[model samples]
Target: MIRVLVVEFTRPDAAAVALGRFLRDEGVEVVHAGPVDTAEQILRTAEQEDPDAVVVLGAEPPSLPGFRVFTTAAEAAEWASGGRSHTADAPSDRAR
Candidate 1:
């Protein structure tokens, strides 16, 4: 099963909760990393969890390699499920 790590900078809002449920419904293992303050903190969580992908919400998009930033929970869910086509703005190995 696909595993995804969801990271946020602040308390999870309705959208974040909804995304967790959506990912669960799609058969993806959702792991919540809770609130983190910096990009390094997020990277640490990712390393610990080692999820297939990382979904960042609210926080500024970090420079971590292979991380995806989404403005909305729906968009993140779609990307996680392979429903969204890759684009220049999509997740890449390049760091920002």
Candidate 2:
């Protein structure tokens, strides 16, 4: 099962919520966070979730651990399009 974290603004909620539900139904652990107002908050949340992938459904980009961040749904789609490649990093504000 893939664990996913989401950092979303208003621009990305619809898709984020929908995907979170869909993934959860599929037996994937989806950690959907936000109405995230800041990158720091996202990093903090991701640390706790420790997800395999961090999905940023927002107008801008988010930063995660060993994970990739996306600005829009289409970008996320592309990042996720490659299947295994989607399982990249998690969110983290820490440098170490």
| lDDT per residue (tens digit) for residues 1-96 in model 2 | 556676785454778777766666656667778687777788888778766667777566654556556655555444444444433363233212
Task: Please list the C-alpha lDDT of all candidates, in the order they appear.
Answer: 0.71, 0.64
Candidate 2: give the clashing pairs.
64-91, 65-90, 65-91, 66-89, 67-89
Give candidate 1's total backbone clashes.
0
* Candidates' RMSD to native: 5.9, 5.4
Each prediction's TM-score versus the true structure: 0.73, 0.66
